[model samples]
Target: MKKVAIVQSNYIPWKGYFDLIASVDEFIIYDDMQYTRRDWRNRNRIKTPQGAQWLTVPVKVKGKFLQSIRDTEIEDSSWAEAHWRSLTLNYRRAPYFEEVAEIVEPLYRNCGDLALSQLNRKFLEAICRYLSIQTSITNSWDYDLLEGKTERLAALCEQAGGTEYVSGPSAKNYLDPVVFKETGIELTWFEYGVYPTYPQLWGDFIHEVTILDLLFNCGKDARDFMKYTK
Candidate 1:
């Protein structure tokens, strides 16, 4: 059966995010949804000596009350440089920092002032390449969106020729499985927190930080600590 996952794009998301991507045959970037403030859409945490630190990408949201993530614009083009600097400062000493940096550093250096959705995709594709994940990534807008959250998700999965729809655990709070059942699509929840600890640089191990943390600390072996990268 063809498995599919539709998720909102996040800025340098945690390892679990990539695990979900790797678990599916087709992954849809659902940036057509409304952008939430102070959410993972424009920020993510990184491990530092002191503790986990946030690197937030400023976006233009002052007047736009209900803007979609695809429509969100970066407030400052320099946020990329600042974030790369933070990563360098915190993870320069990690075992695999240089190798991962060679792949990630150029993305930051060349990222232009693109929309939030476009920016997130650039990083996601780069990391997927590094991890050798071959899942097909597409956009939600590529298909005709239907009304209702459950209806829309089921429709997207069906349109993508997916017999099964894999979602994260958090969506169980409000996601109606009956919709998928009616559409004849099997529904499944992705499990997180199963990853093993790696050679992290910080004092305490935090699994919620960005995937970059795992990449810098474990390099090519980062897939060993993850559940579905293989």
Candidate 2:
């Protein structure tokens, strides 16, 4: 049975994102949706000396609807440099710092004011390659799907020749199981639970940071560690 998973692109998302992708046959990047402010699109948590710190990407908003993640303009280019420096300083002692740095440093340097969606896609691809994921990754826009949540999602599955659809836990609230069943497609849900122990930089470990944190500290073990929630 062919399985598919859909999710919005997040900036250097958590290990759970990659975990879901790795578990699926085809991973769809749901970038056609509206951009939410103060969300994972622009910001994510990271470990720091004091405590958790938020690493945020600034976006330029024009109007609604027409706004696409591909159109999001970074507010400050210098932020990327600062972020690179911060990660280097914080994770320099990490066992996989050099490896992670080699992958991430160029991302920081090359990302000189680009679209949010483009940036996220690049990051996602990099992470997937690093983790040796074999699933096919695609974008929603590539299908030219119609508007509306259910319609677009169903259409995407059909376009991809997917007979089964997997969704994040959030879909449980509104997505009707019968609707998908009627469409001759089976809907499965996956819940992302947190890992009990992740690699620590300096202080007590912080969870839910970008996947980079996991890769930097845990190295190859990060992939297997992410599979276990508890």
Candidate 3:
């Protein structure tokens, strides 16, 4: 059966995002949804000496609520350089710094004012490439389907020729199982349970930070590390 997963594009998302991508045959970037402030749409956590800190990308909002991710724009281009420096200083001593640096440093140099969704999609692609994930990824807008939560998602899955849709745990609350069944599709839920582990840092490994923390400390072993808990 054709399997697919749908998720909103996140900036430097957590390890679970990669897990979902690896688990599915096709990963659909649901970027057509509304953007929210102080959400994963443009920021994520990273490990720091001070503890877990947020790395945020400024966004320009037209109104109180984001109508769509496509309408959200990056507010400051300078933040990219600052964020790069912060990551460099924190992870310079990491085992995989050199390898990941070569892959991530160019992102800062290529920064420009773009939509939050677009920037995140690019970052997601970079992370997938670095980890050698072969899943085919596509954006929701490319489907040319209907809009709205249920209709949009169901139509997108159909357009992609997906018979099964894997969704985040939160989707369980709103998604009607019967609706998906009627559409000739199966709904599967993904729940990521990340166990705490020591990273290559000062002392006492932190948890729930961005996937960068996992990459920096575990390096090439990050993939294996994730599999242990699963």
TM-score list, all predictions: 0.98, 0.92, 0.93
The TM-score leader among the candidates is 1
Error of 1 at 17 (Å): 0.3
Shift of residue 144 alpha carbon in model 3, Å: 2.8
Worst ten in a row by lDDT for model 3: 221-230
Clashes of 1: 0
Error of 3 at 197 (Å): 2.1
> Candidate 1: misplaced stretches above 4 Å?
none
Give per-residue lDDT, candidate 3, residue 100. Answer: 85
Spell out the clash pairs found in candidate 1: none
Give the clashing residue pairs of candidate 2, or none.
none
lDDT of each: 0.94, 0.81, 0.81
Candidate 1: worst-modelled 10 consecutive residues by lDDT: 193-202
**What are the runs in model 3 whose C-alpha is more than 4 Å off?**
62-64, 194-198, 228-230
**Backbone clash tally (model 3):** 0
For residues 63-138, write the lDDT of model 1, one tens digit per residue. 9999999999999878888999999999999999999999899888887878899989999999999999999999
lDDT of 2 by residue, 1-230 (tens): 88888888899898888888988899998877778777898777777787778888878774554576655667778789878887887778889989878888999899876788888888988878888888899988778686667767877887888899989898888777776777788898887775668658768766778888888887777877877221
